[model samples]
Structure formats: C-alpha cells, structure tokens
Target: MKITGIETFCLRYRMPYALTYPRGEYQEREAVLVKVHTDDPNIYGWGEAAMWGGPFSTTTTVLEKQLQPLIVGQDPCCPEFLWEKIYQETYYHGRKGILLSCLSGIDIALWDILGKVAGQPLWRLLGGFARPIKAYASSGYYRRDYGLDALAADVGKAKSAGYRGYKMKVGNLGAAVHSRVLHETPLRVSFQEDIARVEAARQALGPNLDLMCDATTSLDAKTAMAYADEFERIGVRWFEEPTQPENISGCAELARRTRIPIAGFETETNKFNFAALMDAGAIQVVQPDVIQVGGITEARKIAAYAQMRHLTFSSKNYSTAVSLAACINLLYALPNADFFECDADPSPWREEFLKSPLFTFDDGIVQPFDRPGLGLDIDEVALSQWVVQP
Candidate 1:
C-alpha cells in the first residue's frame, strides 16, 4: 500500500531533576514521533527519531517540510528504497545529522506498516534471532548533589529492581567536547571520582551482575586504556564510546590494548561509518542507536556485518518508549543478540504514554512483543499534552 500521509509530534518532557551524561545535561527530554498513514486507514505505523542534542524543530522541520513530502505517495512496503531516496536527495546537507534522524523515523514507521500488512511482528519479520534477551540498567548520571552515597543508593535500587547488567557514566571532568558543542557545562566526574562511582555500584550490585561503563566520548584512548585496567579489575562488562566517534584509530587502539570489550559509536550515523569501525577493529560491540542510525534497514545491515565479523550488535537507546519498543524488536531480530540498553530514567513517555507495556521482564530477562508490526498500543491522549504545536 502507498503511504498517504505523515504526522509528526514534537514532544517535550520536563524531568523531575536534570539528567547529566558526560555529553551534556537534560533538564527536559525531547523526541520526535512519526505516524505514517497508508491507503488503508486501519494500517499505520509509529516511529521515533532522536532530536540530536538540539532543538526538536531541527529534525521535525525535515520530517514535516522536507522528507515527508518525498515519501507521501511512495510504496510503504519499499522502505529501503525510500530511505535511500531521501538520503541521496539530501546528501550534501543531510549526510550525518538530524536529517538522517528524520529519515530514520519515516523508515521505522514504514516498516511498521509492512509488518502489519504481513500480520507479523517486526522481530519475526526481521530475523527472530531471540525471543528473550538480557537488558542492562542505564542509569547513574552526574546529577547535582549526587554524592557517592547517593550514587550507591541509586545503583542499589537498579540492582534490586531486577536488572542483570548496569552502565554508569565515567571520565567527564577531563578532556571532553560536550560543553563546547552542547552550549552548557554538565556535571562531570574525574577518572578518580568515576572509579569510586563504579566501586560503589559494584559494591551495591554484589559483583555477579554485569557492570558496564559509558565514557560518552569523553576520554582519549590512552586515558581509557589506563582506566580499563581498573575496569577489568572491577569486572566491567564493556567500555562504551571510549573516545569520540571521529577517533576510530584511538578506539581501535584502546580495544586492542584492553581486555574489556570496547563498544561504541552510538553517535555515528549509517553503516559506512560502522563498517569503518569494524574494519579498523575499533569496536568489539557495535552499538548503534536505532534513531541516530538509519532505522531498521541500516541497523539490520550493521547486525549482519557484526554477525559475519563475530562481533556483538546491540542497541544504545536513550530516547523514548517508541524507540525503546523499536529497539526491543530490533534486539530480538539481531543475528548477534546482546543486552538491550534500558533507560532507567523514569518518565511518562516510558510508561504513561503507552496504552500498555510493550514487553515484560521475567526475573531479569526481557522478552519481545508477540503482536503485529511494532506491537504498540500508544495512548495518544496521554501523549497529547507533551506534543508541541507549531
């Protein structure tokens, strides 16, 4: 069926407290959701695009005024073709930023439509690699007044909340780019402070559960390598974005020197950059955000490459419930299934915006949806208040 229309909602949610990563702090979280209507009014698909670390309009403008127009009359079943068309048509200005993010949202919605048409869930339609998978608690940001004791208490909650893996921020007080690019300074922890943070989490976690570190593209390979020894000592499951995405060689060097698996490039765009990371041995675990990258079409390609290269393919999700649901399906579909990054941040988008939970965690293992398409039942009324009108 042909795509008839595309609707975009630029959503903004005020956090109870500022959430800080090495990259920056979020006083409010924003995401752009897309709904693609097809010839059959009953068949529509939902998608979410990460708005970079900037204004929502940056991506929504492209989704509404630019890319949406290109695909309105096209076949929804041929998402790959439409994705490429948008990419090629906007190549000069849109190679690696919010434009690709907009394309990602459209592509995801199109795939959702296709899955509904075929009466299959995206996981089964993609590959159905695993029905149940492990998930990691992605918490422990550098919040104001969040001391070591507070950090331990927060991590303790995640461990007791039934997560088998945990990832916390590290190495932001030193060399980093967020302040320069993101327009503000964020709470940063030194390597020394980060060590204490990890130690506290490890103590709170009791050592059996896997613990990971996200440097958030803040450290150099040398610094990362130096800290990696301690990370391995503390049994860090992996090191994520050890350095900036541009430093492919640095990340490769760190990956080679450290025994801890180096995971990265969530900030990266499409398969080409990921292929370079793989070819250079820069990353042992390929972590591509479904929204930052080119949606399912590109992520599936990266997963195949990861499978062929004997690497782990994982989703680095920090977006909303729409993306979380999308990534959940993607993780189950991956040929190389690994841990799904669950945003431990409490928000209405994660629970209240959805009509029902997309998946359930049995003990600590997360399961995928058994329904058609993305298997989403969104509560639009609940979502409406967060929607920005332009």
Candidate 2:
C-alpha cells in the first residue's frame, strides 16, 4: 500500500531516579515517536527514535520538515530502498547524527508495516530463528544519594527478579565533581573506591551470574587498560565504551592490551565506521542501537558483518519500549546474539507507555513477541501526557 501520512511526537518523561554519568546528571528521558499511515485500511506502523540523554526536537524536526514530505506517496514495503533514498537525498546535509536518527525511525516504521502486511512476526519475517535471547539486567547507575551499599542492594534485587547477568555504570563524574576540574583532570574513578564498588556488586551477584561494566566513553586508553585488568580479575564479561567513541585507535589499543572484550559503537551511525573499528581489532563485542544506527535495515548489515568477523553482536538497550521491541526482533535473527540489554531502572515511560506487556524475564531469557509487526500497542492516552508541542 502507498504511504498516506506521517506523524511525529516529541515526548519527555521524568525518571523515578536520576542517573549520573561523566557528562552530568539526567532526571528525564526524551524520545521522538513516528507513526506511518498507509492507504490500506487499518494498517499503520510505529517507530521511535529515542534520545536516552540527548535532545529530541532536532530529530523530530528532521522527520517532519525534511524526510516525511519525501516518503508520503512512496511504497511502504521497500524499507531498504527508502532508507537509501533518504540517505542519498540528505547526504549534502551530512550522512550521520540527527539526520540518520530521523531516517532510522522511519525505516523501522516501514519494516513494521511490512511485517503486518505479511502476517508474520518481525523476527520470523527477518530470519525465522527460533531460539530465545538472554537478557542482562542493565542497571546500577550512580544515583543521587546512593553509594556502594545501595548499588549492592540493587544488584541483589535484580538477581532475585531472575536476571542472570548485570551491567553497572562506572566512570561517573570522573575524579572530581566540578565540571571545570573534570575537564582538566583525567576521566577515571578513584581506583580503590571503584574497585570496592565492583567488589560489593560481585559479592552480591555471586560468581555464577555474568557481569559487565560501561564506562560511557569517559576513560582514556591508559586508564581503561588499568580498569580492564581489575575488571578481568572480578570476572566482568565485557568493558563497554571505556574511552571516547571517536577514539578507534585508542579502543584498539585497549582491546589489544586486555583479555576482556571491548564492547562499544553505540554512538556510531554508519557501517563504514563500524568496519574501521572491526578492522582495528577494537571491539570484540559490538553493541549497535537499532534506533541510532539507521534502524533494523542498517543493524542487520552490521550484525552480518560482525558474524562474518566472528564477533559477538548485542544491542545497547536503554530506550523506549518501541526500541526494545525492534532490538528483540533484530537480535532473534542473529546467531551471534549474546545478551539483550534491558534497563533495570524503574520508570513509568518504560513500563506504562505501551498497552502490550513490557518484556518479562524468565530466568534471564526474553522471547520476541509472536504478534505481527513490532507487536506493540501504544498507549495514546499516556503518550498525550508526555507529548511536547512544536
């Protein structure tokens, strides 16, 4: 069916608990959701470009003012062709960042529409893989009044909730609290204190459950190497974005020096950059966000490349339910799918925005929805409360 109309919404929802990273503290999450209406009766599709800690208006503008006008009369079934069409048309404006983020949302919506037309679940439609993917509780962010003890308790609660693995945030605020001093200083934690926190989490999680750490691109190669050595001792499954995302060579250096797998490229937007990272022996485990990496179309290409290179392909999960659903569909099709990242943080946006049941963990395993398309029914009433007027 031909495309009829495209609608975009910018949403902002306050979080239950504010999280601190190297950049700063975030108390709210933002997202840009897109709805693609087609000529066929009762057949619309949904997609989202979630800005975990970034601004949403710019991407929303790109979708409404630039990309939407071009795709209204085109065929919704040809996602790849449409993706390339948008990319090439927008290349003069730049091929990455906000532009790609907007294109990604639209691409996902097209795939959702295609799946609905075919009367098949997206995972089956994509590749027909039958195995369930394992999910790791991705929580343990640095909270306002919380310390190591609080972190340990959080880890314990996640384990009790049936999560078989956990990923915690590190490199928070670096060595100092003041922004000016932080710029002059190195991005690193107080070594002994950071080790103590990991020790507490390790003690709480026990040795059986898998553990991972994300530095959020804060530490330099030297500091990351030191952290990697210590994390390997504590049995951390992988170290994520230890240095700045642009530092491909630095990430490569860190990977070469340590046995722990380097997992990153969540900030990346194209396949060419991913190829560079892969060729440099930089990341053993590649975490591509479907919403940020040009939706399932581009993510499938990256997964195939990772599989060919014998690397682990996992997703960076910390966005809207739509993003999670898209990731589950994509991950289900890949044989190298390692662990699905699910935000362990409590937020109404994550739990209450969708009418469909949020993914449930059964002994740390999560199965993709069997319904056609992305299998999500948006809560329009709740969405109205968070929508921002342009």
Candidate 3:
C-alpha cells in the first residue's frame, strides 16, 4: 500500500523530578512524534524523534514539510530506499544531528507499520536475535544534584528496587568521593567519570563493584591514555566516549592503549554511523538509543553488526515507559544482548502513559513479553493530553 499522510506532534511534559546531567538539568522533556497513515484500510504507524536545533535547523518541521511530503505517496515498505532518498536529498543541509533524528523516528515508525501489516513483530521482521535483554538501573542522580550520601541512597534505592546493575553520574566529583559514594549501592555501579578521576575511583572502589567510567567525549586521545594506564589496576569493564563521536580515530587509539573495552554510540543517528565507529576500532560496545537512534529497525541492525564483530551491544533508555516498552520489545530480538537502561526516576506520569509497563527487578533485569508489536499498548488519550501544540 502507498503512504497517505504524515502528521506530527510536539510533546512536552513536566517531569515530576528533574533529570540532571553534567551538561545541564531538564525539568521538562520535549520531543516530536510522527504518525504515518497509509491507504490500506485502517493501518497506521507511530514514531518518535528529537526536535532539536530550533530556529536554525527545524528537524521535525523539515521532516513534516519536506521529507514527509516526499514520501507521502511512496510505498511504506520502502524504508531503505526512502531513507537513502531523504539522506541524499538533505545531505547538504542535514547529514547529522536533528535532521537524522527526525528521519530516525519516521523510518522506525515505517518499519513498525511494515511489521504490523505483515502480521509480525518489529523484532521478527528485523531477524529476531534473542529475547529478554538483561537491564541495568540507570540511577537518576548527578554530582551537582545530589550529595554523596544522597547519591548513595539513590543507588541503594535502585538496588532495593531489584536492579542488578546501576549507573551513576561522575566527572563533577572527586574520584575518592565518587568511589566512596558508589560503595553504598549493592550492585554493579558504573560512574560517568572523566579521565582525571579514573585512577582515584579505581583505588577507592577496588576490584569488586563493576566500576566503570564514562568520558563523555570530553578527553583527547593522548589525555585518555593516561587513564587507560590505570585500567589494569581498576579492572575497568568499559571506558565510554573518551573523544568526540566524530573522532573515531581518537577512539581507536584510546581503545588500543587500554585493555578495557571502549563503549559509545548513544548519540548515533543510524547504522552507518555505528559501522563507522566500529570500523575505526573505536568501539567495543555499541550503545544505541531506542528513540534517538531510529527505533527498532536501525537498533536491531546495529546490534546485528555488533554481533558480527563479536562486540557487546547495549541499548540506552531515558524516555517514558511507552518508549521503554518499545525498547524492551527490540531488546528481546538482540542476539548479543547486554544490559538495558531503565529510567529510574520517580515519575507516575511515565507509568500513566503506558498500558503494560516493563517488569523491572532488584536484580536489574527486565523481561520481554509474548504480546504483539511492541508488547505494550499505547495510551492514545494520554498521548493527546501531553501533545505540545505549535
């Protein structure tokens, strides 16, 4: 069947709690959702993408105005071709960032529609790899936001909630305090540490905690190596984003210097970008976000690629339960599935937006469902209520 129309929704929701990162704090979250309609009876598909680079680069606006128009009358099953067309056409103006994020959502939604039309799940259509990916509790705390004791308590909260693995903020705190604070949590606690604090955290946490660090594209190749030397002592499981995402060469060099595996690609737009990161020998673990990285279509492909390379593949999650449900369905389809990220912040609305929420445990595991499509029904009314009119 051919495409009929595409509609866009800008959603804004005030968070019950704030989400703080080293970069900034978010009290409210904003994103755009796409609904693609087809000529076949009552079939439709849904997708979500980032609406960033406002004014200068209207990602969703361009997608709704230009890209969506181009694909309106085209075949819904032509995701690859349509994606390539959008890429080539928008290459001069939109190769990376917001443009790609918009394309990602639409492309993902199209795949979901294709799966529904075929009477199959998105994972099955994408070559069902595995099911029930092990998940980690992504503790919602930052150095600036919570005191060391409070951060430790949050980590404890995640452990008590049945999360087996957990990740916490780093960079802003001293390595010694970061390590001491993590000791309060019971499970594997990975920190968002910079290269400067690597040695100190290693010394403090010692060998037991599954202590890892994230550089967040903040360090150069040479500087990253200094921390790389301490990996042996710290027994680091992974070193994440030591250099900018585009600096694959630097990532490669850093990986080569340390025995620890380098993890990255959360901000990646497509499988091609992931392939580039892998080719550079810059990554040992591929982290693709369900919403930001083109949904399940591209996520499964990227995971498959990581599997081919015999590398670890982990998916990132920071959205609501609806988005998490979508992620869980795809994670069920991964072969070399690693830990999944569960948004640990206390948000009742996040729960209110979903029909069947994820089953998270103190052991840090989330099981996949036998249900159809994403396994969880979307709350259309709730979606409408949160819609941001523009």
Candidate 4:
C-alpha cells in the first residue's frame, strides 16, 4: 500500500484530581495524538504523546512544524528508517527533548500501523515473550487527606488486587506519614523519594521494603553519593537519576562507589543515548518513558539492550490510560520487564477518551491484554470535545 495522509490532534483534558509529582502539579493534561491513515482500506493506527509544557517542551506545535514535514509522505511500515530520518533531520533544530518526544509519538504510531498492516499484535510483531510483568501500585496522590490511612488502604487494595508491590511518594513530608507507610503497609512497598530525603525515608521505612530514590536529575555526584551512603545503611535498592542525564561520568562515579542499582534515563529519547547510559557503568536499571523514549518501537530495542547487559527494565508510567496501555503492551513483550509505575489518580478525561478502559488492576497486578495493537481505540466524541486549536 502507498502512503496517504497523517492527521494530528492536540487535546487538553482537565484532570479529575490534581497530579503532583516531584517537579510540579498539573490539573489538566495536554496530549498530541497522531492518526496515520492510508488508502488501503484498513483501520488507522494511533499514537499519542502527551506533552508536559514548558519552553522547548514537547507540544503540538513541535509535532506539526518540526516532525510532520519529515514523515508525511514516508511509508508508515518503514518505522526503523523513518525514525532515523526524523532523528537526523531534527538533530540541529530539535534534537533532545521536545523534538524527540514529538517524533516518539509519530514513531509509535508508525509501528502500530505496521503491526496492523502485518495483521499481528504489537507484542508479536516485536518478537513475543509471555512473561508476567509485575506491576507496582503507584497510588497515594489522592490520599493526601487521609495520608497514612490512604497509603495503608491503597497498599492493602493493591495487594488485594494482585499486585506484588506499590510505590509511595516521599518528599520532605514529616515523620507522621512515613511511619504509617513503613510500619503499617502489608505488601512490599517501593518509595520514589528525592535523593536528599532517601536516607531519612529508608531509615524510617526500614530494610524490608524496596526503597528507591529518584533524584529526577536533581542531584550531583556528591549528593548522590551521600544519598547512596545513607541508602547503604538502610539498604535502598536503586538510586534513580542521581545526577543529570547528560552527566555520564558523574553517574559512573556514583555507581562505582555505591552498591545500589543506578536507575535513570527516563527522559532519554532514543537508543543511542540509551547505549551511552548503559556504557556509563552507572545504570543497572533502565527507566525509559514510553512516550518520551520513542514509544513501543524504541522501548523494545532499549529493553532488549538492557536485558543483554543484565539490567533491570523498569519503565516510567504516569500519563493517560492510552499511554499506560501502550507501555503495558511493550512490557508484555519483554523478558526482563520489571515493575510498572502505576498511576493511582483518577482521570475523568483519560477514561472518557479511551475506546475501552485497560484491564483493571487487582491489588497491584494488571492483567495482560491479548488484543491487537495496544488494544485501545480513541473515542471520537471525547477527542472532538477536548480538541485544542492552539
């Protein structure tokens, strides 16, 4: 079949609850979705990249102006070639962040289209592996009122749901919240706290629970080492992004001094940098964001590379359900798939936009989907209702 047309939509949906990560808080979600259609009379494949805003961020503008021109007439099935072409052409103008993020959405869509064209599911197309990927409940955002009770209930809920574990956010929150989570929760709990607070949290949470500190590109090598030192006392498992993503030497140094597994590169765009991160001798866990890391196509390659090096494949998950479902599909395809970062916040807009809500989590485990090509359909009505012109 020949190339046809690519349609792009930018939608903004208000969140049902506030989404507060370490960086900031957002009440609404803005996403850029691409629909690639051909004249060959088949279902169109869809890919979405929800851009978190800032200057030079991944926005709809990046998708339309920087990326569309490069791949409009290109064959959607030739994702590998198209991915390289877009990366090379945008190297000068939009290389690292937004450019790659926009291209990631297109690249994912292209792969989806290719899979449909070949009449196979995305996992099968990418070389199928049927390992049950463990999902960790990432709830705790909504329980701000109940705090420990919320944390305790959610942990219980996740374990009851069948999840092996859950992740609780830790910051400079006082000892009250920390005590309840570390002492009360029954299931294995993981903590995604800042590097600065990891030691204190680990000491409070104790040795049994898996403690991980996400520096979120916030710490330098020295600070990372300090956190690592504290983590050693309490036995934290991984130090995520102790230094900046570009600081390969700093990461290497931290990894050398600490026994903790260095997990990072969630913001890294493609496999080239991923190769560099692997080479850095710092990262033992690869955390690639499906939306930012070239969607399923590049994610699979990155995961494969991590597995080859005996690194754990832990992906960053917390977006709309469509992106979450896409990540799960990719996770299902991998052999070394580790914990999935599950979002516990309720998103009304996200739910309405999906053709079908993904498999619900039991305790903390989500059932693998057997449907073709991510198994999600875009709700046209919801899309139209939330469509953004600017």
Error of 3 at 6 (Å): 1.7
Off by over 4 Å in 1: 177-186
Which candidate number would show the highest TM-score if scored against the true structure?
1
lDDT of 4: 0.68
Q: How close is candidate 1 to the true structure, as a TM-score?
A: 0.96
lDDT of 1 by residue, 7-28 (tens): 9898888888997877677788
Ten residues in sequence with the least summed lDDT for candidate 4: 170-179
**Per-residue alpha-carbon lDDT of candidate 4 for residues 85-110, written as tens digits (9 for 90 to 100):** 98778778765677677777887777
The segments of candidate 3 whose C-alpha lies over 4 angstroms from its true place after superposition are: 52-57, 143-145, 173-212, 226-236, 346-350, 358-363
lDDT-wise, the better of 1 and 3 is 1
The per-model lDDT (C-alpha) reads: 0.85, 0.83, 0.66, 0.68
Clashes of each: 0, 0, 8, 8
lDDT of 3 by residue, 8-121 (tens): 777777766665443344567666777788998667777767654253237557777878877988999877888778878888877767777777778767876777777776
Give the runs in model 4 whose Cα sits over 4 Å from its true position. 16-21, 55-58, 139-156, 170-211, 233-235, 360-364
Instruction: Write the number of the candidate with greater TM-score, choosing between 2 and 4.
Output: 2
lDDT for position 221 in model 3: 77
Candidate 2 regions with alpha-carbon error over 4 angstroms: 52-54, 173-189, 358-360
Q: How many backbone clashes does candidate 1 have?
A: 0
